[model samples]
Target: MSAAPESPAERQAIDRLFNPRSIALVGATERSIWSIAANDNLRRFDFKGSIHYVNPKGGTIFGAPAATSCAAVGAPIDAALLMVPEAKMIDVFADLEAAGVGGAVILSAGFAELGENGAERQRAVAAAAKGAGIRILGPNCLGFANFVAGAPIWTTPLRRPMADARVAIVSQSGAIASQLEQFAYQQRVGVTHMISTGNEADITIADAIDYLARQPEPRAIALFLESVRDPARFAAAVQAATAAGKPVVLLKVGTSEATARAAQAHTGSLVGDDRIFDALCRKLGLSRVHSLEELIVTADLFARLGPVECEGLALTAMSGGMCEIMTDQADAEGIAIPTLADGTLKRLREALPPFATPANPLDITGAAMLQPDLIPTALAALASDASVGALGFVFDAPLKDDARGFARSFIRHIGEGFKAAGKPCVMMSHTFSAVNGEAREMTDSAGVIYSGGGVRHGVSALGHLAAHHAWRRRAAAAADNVPAAAGTTNAARPNGERDVLDYLATAGVPVIPARLARSADEAVAIALALEANVVLKIASPDIAHKTEVGGVALNLRGEAAVRNAFDTMLARVREAAPAARIDGIVVAPMRQGGVELFVGTMNDPQWGPAIAVGLGGIWVEALKDTSLRLLPIGEQDALDMLAELRGTKLLDGFRGAPAADRQALARAIVAIGQAALALGPDLVSLEINPLLVDGARVEALDGLTEWKESE
Candidate 1:
């Protein structure tokens, strides 16, 4: 709606398009399900706008005289739903433009989603819409609905509104939009807007998010994404939403790494499409979930509770078994279930039956079943604990005809307990179930936030709440300390391993000292100066893995051994890769025993510069256990990335070895990322393999850089 990064006037125009006062259904017919559903939804939603039916062949449609075209309507039409054939779009747009239609929803298929020819056709249609001064949503998509405004342009069976809806759903697939709406309503989670951005030829998901970010209705946004169409707009829109204090939750598919991993470095092997998106999410403060149910539950909880502000959850249940189940799941989800303070326990003990205990995940015992008021008393005491950020009670909401007898009084007291506590609290189901209207009314009357996802999904949602809160603080702090990535312009172009070390040395990154030896005599002379065992390596910009080509000879001492190895290694490399351009041998002292860390940077086609850090050597490819983040990261972000690695424990002096200096290592990782960015846009990958973290020392043992070929 607000196509942000667009002018203010343009944003207002798009906003008007989404909330149009009048509509024209161009292909309305009795035989088409789409047309029937569209009309039915408008009526059901009580949309109080003028609706016009138009067809190429004018006739009676929807019990009204249908206009032959938009021009024949003889009224200022704000928006038109074009249900005509793809081939007829050119002519139809002409008619709409002449009639001064401001926006068009192209429901016709056979556009960009079909590939080359379809893409070409879509381009033409986009041009036509632009020439007509109209904004378009999609040529292949289910239309949108604005619940707050009572507007329904959607062409699917619509559910009744949830009066106080606060979450908005945006999806790439029309079908997924429908599914999300159905699920959201089923969970008793109301939605303010539902938009399907299928084949986003004109208005993309970024435009939708940017528009929604300005609204006061939706407190949290849920995104079902297949891919990103505009990275810059997407980032800006998410930032706007974050600034608005609205959390964005994303559920995406497709994790193919084949294309991103096609390079001559280890970094490429670890970079995937989804990993890049994951890195972007971390940078943007988005809560990412994996399942459809998680997507809704997390967003719903985010909307209802906002951020938890603290890191712990206090839970209660009637049965010991249920309490155990919730605790186990909480532990699994990494949710902190803090123990109640002494004062909280004393108050709980005073109010509870003698046999009952006072603990976090406390079992209230069946005594509360008869004396229902005891439940709220226990809850109030639990909520008083300083360790509890938020509290939850596992009470399954009743279905139809079940909200009678003791249940009514029980729910009322639970509501009283929630109010008296004055904390963010929720009533969760013991098992996954839907909230019927009667149950919904019962909870709403008590002012209780409820989730039918029950224990598993509900606990996971709490975990997300805490995690997102923590991320926001970290992201805020990180913003202040991000180091600038300006590289020296006069620095020599790094063509090989030796040149890369020279470049890194300028940035305070310690590198293994080395010298170029053009001949056997030069190799022996370089070895004599080192005063220790030296290693000889072929220095060629064209060669990457030196071991495979026999271009590396490690731990050689004395003039005889150094001279023989340099001459023999060159011969071997020539036989293996004859066309490679050799820049002579690199002779350096051979040091032993250190933690091998792999730090690499990649220029992603979609996410831009990013870096990966993990255990180096064979473990890099064999374990494939690495952590990634978008580049230009602060030292704390780099530290967080290292902490996320599975083999991170090895850095703490494993098996009686020297413990690596993590702060020093983190700075090194950040420096490498900055260096990679400074190499400019032509860089494909910059790698520091086996970074050699020995004791308190960290140095770059070897370095490599790959560049894009000049076209």
Candidate 2:
């Protein structure tokens, strides 16, 4: 029996359809093409639940008695399938609402796809369903299936048995979802559940994921999203799935600007900023696939093979040419295949002929195909060796009758041997001839992940699988004990340089101390009091980039120099932003430090707040060498962000220069994240450019923050 549903309303809806006492098929007809196909599909599957057909002009459908309307069913309906015309969808929904329908699968297209008039009708349907507390699947969709219960409520008929499967397929495109289902059926791979979220008007992909996460059968979820409506909610769902030990493989299509615009016009969904979405996915541990085929193949492997334990890989092929090709591809893709040890090589040579070379990608010669047991023996030897964690098998077909059988036997024996020895193996099969049933059975039964197409595809899948494993390991190890604040703080205000510096100091970000002076004598006195070479700047909240306005003068060595520079800077500021209000000349002691860095934090309305750190000074924008991390980051995360910078060489003692204090830099970034979290939406932007780093300290030379009024 299927497990009890956990999501209250969602469970009620699923249970009502899968194990319902009765179901009413609205818009059912003897002449409708969908009805005829659906009726035949139901009979073929031998569904045990009570089925009632409802059609206004119905006589009978597939030998089942018909009802003039949903109310004519004369019993409480659990779920109703509305395969009606677009114009009549709302009215039929109203009738179902009046009849107290529990849930509905709307297979109508006119609601959202037919322009304004249809959109109004779609709204009406949604309003009626919400008012009646009825859960809806879609107004323009292919519907869903609950495999365990033999519940195939989809518009298209499916007759395959629901094998115990671990992967759940969810897609925004109906065609992609159907393709995945067909692919799985052809591979003899079972599907736990499949859902096509068409025109996500009411229920969304995130909601489906949140609900499906409660199911125990799906060990992984394969998602194909054309657009994302709620980025934060999607991030949260992905995080929840990760916490539950279930990986999510996602294929996000239509990322280009033109494609995004097309998606918006097609579904009325905000395509969202691509960069922010990509960053969110990385932060939340969602493995991204680039194509539909890759998504299906990777998901299937992850579901069947489970997680790979180690990064070490060993490639074994019968031909030297294939080995060379595999090696070059693996190197280009960053797949590390360690060289075999001397002892391992010696043992392999003893097992095979003296001419056999036992390198990383062991080429035991094409003659091994004649030996039949040679391939499995070599695999067994490698499996026993501690040097190899995983193995790759490349098969080249020969023009012999037993060639197919030999390949089949080799796959089965090696697959069982690897499992027994606690190792994983993937196979690459290249042949112009069509793959027969015997070859497929051997590949599947042996638990070998087969790459039936191209060598690059097989390598790419292994590389992705390895990368995912590494990502999970890093994420797990980086879990820190930083407590989140109860509420965000507010720091939005138009303040001069002094006030901005004070706020940064209060947030635990180190900044240079300075005093504001109204006149040249005051500036001279402040510079003299510090007893060091000073930097002078106009302290105006209106002039954020003071250098552009000629308001900044560095290396004011004495009182005379300070006085002269202050007067000249004041006149330049007045000339630059003539209408702007001038604050005063600010003087601060200057200290030589290594490396200029820029660190900033901003609150994105869609994906929450994020912090970025990069090479500072004029090249910050031009080079754009930066790394971003989600807000509320811990010290470790801050350090990782800094380490990821391409300009990290500047911090690592470049050209005989002393290395900058990365620890202090990390602390400053973490502080920035804390300030962002505390400031909430009231804070617009917080930037500290040209932050100086010395032996064990870092100082923010300049700081600025923009604010928004609170509701």
Candidate 3:
């Protein structure tokens, strides 16, 4: 984890930057939309702090006398909103510093994002702020609003601060931040803070997370990230948030493999930026969502429910079609709607009509319309089920007909049932809709936790909820059970196939026994000693794919066959890759009829060491089916990776082959990761492909290492 501010002074400055008692709006004007919105928000939030608007022209703004500049305001400002153009920042910072400004939010564009010239200008601005001992929030971005503190320094229009706000939003894009806030409001999810870190000149998303995790109001944090500047800092912030019980729901943009780096091995070529991020999310237990709606909805659910103790979610709906839809969605989301306990099923059967059959996604049918009491009855029955962790019910919230209070009784009964059930519960709409004031009031008064995201997004949130709990548990266990490190002792740089396998063996990884053969006679002698059919391959540090160069001959028997194969392979490799240094032939007993597994370790520049495992050979690349996790992984983590593979059935002894020993395979994988870590950072990757597993025997068939330039 990354280290943070080392002193209380730094902590206090961050606190004052977001929740200041006094602020100055430099360059405030009545005509500009930004000025108008910023002023409007202060009034809307009933900001009690001193709000000083400054203009060099200085006459009147917002019906109050405007100061000529912050210096003229004659008071120390805890935070200053600089709304001037970039050309005038030099003088603006002078005036801000004169007034003892603690933090500055630059609301101008044309810096850092425009090219080299803009980057230079941004640097000058940063230097000026630093010289003045002031922290900067943005040099090109929207400002923030602290609703909990009634401080609105934002430059966009907003609805009233959400009551009982629990979710906080922080984004790299101001425009995206605005969209997220509007969507959160539409979903009736209250927000405590909305921060945008434009260009991240001084204060970045990592800093915001570090600060917000310690704040009291936000129950969950929703992030929209384009990039991270400091990975270690970001990781530390995430760890802090997780420890605080503040679930972080992430929405990142890049997923296309277009950004993947070209490398010499399959592991380096296949591991992309997004997959590494996904591995990071698993390590930190973050709820990573794909779209904007998913981001807000998942965060809302996370705020309502943290780590869950139970494993399943119990759902009910009044219509059979809605029940079917929910069931399908549950399956797609990997959410368990477990079978109802026998006692709970009996109770549900007793309460429902004779036609109703009790099941997981209980279908109350049309009987719920007349008998609203059935809502509570079903809730009580489902809540008692051992597998259920949470409950959800599907019913479209009234758009306008609710004026007659038609659904009031139904909502009231459901809410009362939820309160009595003593478990987290939410009522979702059958379709996506808006939650207007009246609808919000109805749910609030009846004590119903409500969502207007409808079935798709609502069920997706429950899926995220389950994943959040599972990830948290797994992450915790991984942290606690980290394998102790034993430094590698075999060699400094293990490059050739034999050398790589030898290094792995020192780390307790099982490797196929092999000896280097300088001549066909030596190769034949080694094959005879094994008393088994042998495989011969030309070993060269430069040649990664020995088979592609006609350098490999497998399943050779007898003296003539072994000798002929060795000679032919050497001649082919020397011709194909003449500059390569040949390490003769690697002769190992050919053990066939077993499952092949791919275990590789890659040292990501930003995330450090990580391991990936998948079906061996072509599937590792063709299917792109693999599971990745950060290094120092436990045996259980390896088992989990194997279980996640698309071709996992092949490991269960497909066809006539013996069942591959999963426990032994997992142990070998753990050792492989430890071996990679021991090689240190200069080694780019270590791959053990076709780690042939036949029953309880697991051995590395062939291995290679790619190293970076030595210091």
RMSD of every candidate to native, in Å, equals 2.9, 5.2, 2.1
Tens-digit lDDT string for candidate 3 (287-376): 888899889888987887555666698888877878888899888767888988899999998999999989878888888888888888
TM-score, per-candidate, Cα-based = 0.93, 0.85, 0.96
Model 3 bad stretches (over 4 Å): 4-6, 255-259, 262-265, 400-404, 484-491
Better of 2 and 3 by lDDT: 3
- Give the per-residue lDDT of model 1 (tens digit) for 1-711: 122468775576678777879989989898999999888988898888889999878899989999998999999888888888899887788898888888878888999989999999999998988888888889898899889988878888999778889999999998999999999989888999998888998888988898999999999999998887778899999989989988999998886354356434458666555777788898888889998898999899999986677778888899999889988988876689997888899999999999998888999988888898897788889888888878888888787645355666678888998888778888889888998888888888887888998888888888888888888888788778888655545344587989998888886788889989999999999999999999998999999889899988999999999988988999999999999999999999997887898898988876678899998976888887889998788899988988888898998898899988999988888888888878887888888887989998898988898878889
Better of 1 and 3 by TM-score: 3
Local accuracy by lDDT, each model = 0.86, 0.72, 0.85
Task: Please identify model 2 stretches exceeding 4 Å from their true place.
Answer: 1-7, 18-23, 94-100, 113-120, 157-164, 185-189, 230-233, 254-272, 310-391, 396-404, 429-436, 451-455, 490-494, 589-593, 709-711
User: Looking at candidate 2, what is the lDDT of residue 68?
Assistant: 90
Residue 504 displacement (Å), model 2: 1.6
Ranking of models by TM-score: 3, 1, 2
> Which candidate achieves the best lDDT against the true structure?
1
Residue-wise lDDT of candidate 2 within 1-711, one digit each (tens)? 012223687657655643445567788877777777666665666667778899888687768778899987878888888888876776776677677777787877877777898778888888877777677777788777767666666777675555557778888877789898877665545688888878766666876786667677778889999877766567667777777767888988665353233222101122234644566666777778787766766776667666767666787777888789889988886787777777777777888877787787778786675675676667777766675666777773222327347556666665664565567777765432234445555666777656553456556666666767777777777665443632665535636778778777888889888888999999989999999999998888777778899988988788789989988998888998998778798889887757888877765555666677888777676777777766667777777777777788778887877887777888887886776577666766677777777657788888777665456
Pairs of residues at least 3 apart in sequence or in different chains that clash in candidate 3: none
